[model samples]
Target: MSKDSSQSFLLSDSAMQAASYSTYQNFQSSPTLCASELQNWKQRIGLFQTHLQTTATPTQGSLFDTTSTQTSLDSIKPFELRRQNTEFWRWQFDDVGVPAMYFVIDYIATAQKGPILLYIGETVKSNQRWKGVHDCKRYLTNYQQAHRDTGLKSELAIAFWPQAPADRPARQKLESQLIYKWRSPFNKENWRYWNTPFITGKEP
Candidate 1:
């Protein structure tokens, strides 16, 4: 062949070889791509099987298991009042007379911790205020005295969780749970339970 024709033929051959090598590489990689796709499909199937098994299994304590309505924490409504306020007294005399769980909170202590649950109690009668001069009240009185003497910040507050008039037992149970959770200082029942010292302005 002439010199130019020979160069053109060599270029065409090189291009053909490159195209063949590219096709060979793609062919070699095809199995790996198929394997990866198959693995992904297997994982998806496994997940689908797990989901089916979970859906088919019966869960204990499901809402539908009981004929009676179950009360959840979300169902409990909370109300707050300053212990010294007239509104606190008025709330006791509310005409509905619902059972309630009450919490004596030190709002000042709450500034350090979350709401300092000083004491917890429940009453069947809405009108009852710590059952007319209880140990809880005495504790509060002593704390107030310390506040006056030492100029300690004392912002005592009360919170109530009123439930249906007939749900006194539930209210009491909730009160016990709150006392256990908060380890309230003045609660006689929790005195032996938490065994933790009271966080008060006074040492003892």
Candidate 2:
């Protein structure tokens, strides 16, 4: 549930100077523009590119089922403990712990006569190589076959896995037990499904 480590990298003085020089020189050829305007444009472009390159990955926190925007993004930290190196953190799975899939339900509309639950899944394998879960539809197929009128349908969200051990049978069993014990709203027909309200808040 937590990150493996946190390490911050500070750019060397020479490297910083070089980067500043490159940014300034990029606008040097614009003879038709005023100096102030050129500097402002460069600053804005730099900020925009930074935004695109650095997104808040799932490791930092969940998206909370909201659309990404300047405000939401600003609410998140620019630098995270998990983002050590771009390539290293990207799709880095947890291999020694829970080597299995996990789900987060996006929404549960209890107001309706037949409310729906949005379930998202993640698959964790060894080698710390993380990938999105694609078997949500397949899992729904199996669930539907077992119970024709359970009314559980698949509504997949952004997927990613954690690092976990190869001996994952325990994880699968735990998931099954949790699902049964909680009687997740996923199984609407069950009396335990949606019996209580679920609350989520924006965590800092």
Residue 38, model 1: lDDT of 32
Residue lDDT tens for model 1, 97-152: 34656667655542223235567777765455543334454456554544444444
lDDT of 2: 0.30
The regions of model 1 sitting more than 4 angstroms off are 1-87, 90-96, 192-204
Tell me the lDDT of model 2 at 78. Answer: 20
Identify the candidate with maximal TM-score.
Answer: 1
Task: Give the deviation of candidate 2 from the true structure as CA RMSD.
Answer: 21.5
The CA lDDT at 34 in model 1 is 36
Q: For model 1, state the Cα shift of residue 14 in Å.
A: 99
Q: Which residue pairs overlap in candidate 1's backbone?
A: none
Residue pairs with backbone atoms closer than 3 Å in model 2 (clashes): 93-163, 94-162, 94-163, 94-164, 95-163, 95-164, 95-165
